[model samples]
Target chain A: MLAGFELIKIAFVGGLISLDSTVFGQFMLSRPIVAGPVIGWLCGDIKTGLLIGAMIELLWVGVVPVGVGVPPDSAIVCIVATAIAANKVPDAAAIAIIFSVPLGVIFKRLDIAHRKWNRVFLPVVENGIENGRYHILTFVIWLGVFLSFIKSFLFLFICVFLFNAILSYILPFIISAPALVKGLQVFMFVLPVLGLASFLASFVK
Target chain B: MKNCNIIRTFFRSLLLQAVWNFERMQNVGFLYSIMPCLKEIYVTDENRLKNAAMRHFDFFNTHPYIANTIIALTLVLENETVAPTGLPSVAASEETKSQQIKSLKLHLGGPIAALGDTFFWARIKPFCGLIAAGYVFIRGFNNIGYFLIPSLIFIFLYNMPHIFFRFFGFWLGLKYKTDVVKIISNFKIQKISEIIRLAGIFVCIFVLIAYIVSSGKYRFAGVLVFLASFILIKKNVSIISVFWGLVIGCVGAGFLM
Candidate 1:
């Protein structure tokens, strides 16, 4: 398991990774396959990162950010889950993934809110143009990127803490229960298939 | 356009969605990317520049990469209407010329966005991701440090086309001007994506077979899970729910047995 200090650093990288989606680069750095393994290595558990990242990537394989459609924030799943699961037992990683998946959905809401909040910048630009302060454009654009960084940072920091606490509490019971362990392990193995199903569906649509 | 401004606009275009808002979606970024050229176009008349800037602040959205082409088209159109050097151009029909640019932008933004959505977002991006994911799933890296091989593959492959298109697309826009659309259509971007997508489908199936073969005891479950998800997604069930439901079911079923 990573230390408290280490978790903070991963959260910072997580913030930058989140930016690649729509905020700036669209570099696919935020993709689970990429972010997962990277964060995994950061946590000193490469296999765990690769495992979680590959599964999440396949799950959303066909999903694209067409128009205003916001896909699930799979990057969140990769970063948080891999960070939490790294070096822990394999079963614990599976548990981490289960909880972390929902966090992506939660982050999506914040993402929408951030975009809505960005409306404030538009009027600022209008004012800048009217007042002939062109430098304001550069300032506001960077500000948008900066604020997006902040949002992802805060989200990752909070999620890592809350999920760590919850998984810590529940993991003992699940480990003790043979049935639950077997079940989660099975889910881990099969999750990729579900991803393929969706991948195929994306083609059909 | 000066090479410096072209380069500047090309870099700025990367920030296309930085301040995206529902009200006017990419208008800010679009205006910002072309700001350098606008400065040059309206250098003599601050008022004209201001109007042009204000006009762009209105509603706008498009696929970010394809937008380079449109932005280039605007540069050509705006340059054409500008009176060369000292001529104080006719003010009456100038409104119509600017209006033509506006209409052109409005018309191009939506359709090109859809086309780009299909070409880049739908096919190209995923093909890169699929290949990378396929590598990870199949290769099963022995060295932890080697994990990045897939990531690097994805980055280099995707960016090769991405950079080429962003820069070249803009150049084509400048060269062809209004006829750039015809040039773009001639490329058959959608056709290329279709082929890439087919390749992706094969990669996907290949990965699935590898997973099933490796699963051993879980092979039957893997097959079942695959079919169940395909059907659910086909019926339009949301992925988040399907995922969460599967998690809960697996945990609960463990208890039931």
Candidate 2:
């Protein structure tokens, strides 16, 4: 588990990065490439962050949030993975990357749920507009933004805390297995090709 | 004053998905961004303002970056309809004018979404990401400054086109009106997208060769993994499955070796 200060710092940075997911700015700050390094830098390991970020970014390059569908939440995955790797646990980066993919899918589902919840406010927004209560518009907008921040903060907090605890126990075992470690290193080195292939696959017509 | 409103709308457009909902997607945010223009156009007419607001409260979903063109075009249309002095007006009746605006949105939304998705998401984003990835692969990610370079490059490259599209799209919308699509088509995004894809593939191949040659051990395995992955992708395998399969295969191969 992260110490109190580290937890606070990660949560704060995670919350800020999460804003890029939707609330404030869609500035590519939320992109795994940027988010991974930023969080990695915060945790004192820029290389791992870049590696993980590039891997995830390439893998999901084809998955764009075009319409109503939310793509997997790559930012959260980047954050969790970078944080784990930054903790300096052997093989933790691989483990984090392996596990974080499913976590991102879970977050995508949560994002859909949040969007559905936002629907309930539509009537209130319409009523406010109809009644000339324009303040309600601002209220609804801020409320949505606030909820997004809270979701990101809580999600990052719990994931980082749990993953840290799990890694602290399992990493020692993984470190003892040189072959497994070599496999992970090889997988990490080759993973970007998959991202590149997936990216190029989009152009295959 | 008119330019100021357009500028304000552009800034507001940056937050166009702040209040996104499942029902209308970006409708509220879209309405919010255009509200300034509506207010300016329908000043002292609450009913007209209410009608304009209500008109925009319907469904809207588009790539947020590309939505700038739609917003700009909508503003231009609204201006011509409400003011109707210099620009060639579509129709005289308010109802017809509103209907025209609505149809304009309907017509533009899908095309813009497609164009934006193709240009920004598929081509530009991936191209920038691959360039950055290539950088990281070529120059090992040991130095913090070196790692930072790719992230910076990715952001700068991606956002340059994004900001340009936002500004140029709005300017074109204001100037050419509906003929903006013609202007867009002339840019030949398809050709550019193809070129970027080719470059990305080259970079990927370069990085793969570099990785294999430098390591001196995983050459055969790397080649096998690449061929296998290419086939899997060709067979329409899901990325997640392909990813896990590759990892498992690597581990299994590691054990055998």
Highest TM-score: give the candidate number. 1
Candidate 1 residue lDDT tens string, A1-205 = 4578987899999999989988886777888888988898888887888888888887777677879887778898889998888877788878888888888788888888888888999878999999999889989999999998988998898888888778877888889999998788778777777887788788755
**Clash totals for all candidate models:** 0, 0
What is the C-alpha DockQ of each candidate? 0.70, 0.63
Candidate 1: stretches off by over 4 Å: B85-89, B141-145
Instruction: Extract clashing residue pairs from model 1.
Output: none
Minimum summed lDDT over a 10-residue window in model 2 chain A is located at: A196-205
lDDT of 1: 0.84
Model 1 per-residue lDDT tens digits across residues B61-159: 998878899889988888777765444557756788889999999999999999888887888777777778777766765643577788788888888
lDDT of 2 by residue, A176-203 (tens): 9888888887887678767766766775
lDDT, model 2: 0.80
Per-residue error (Å), model 2, residue A137: 1.9
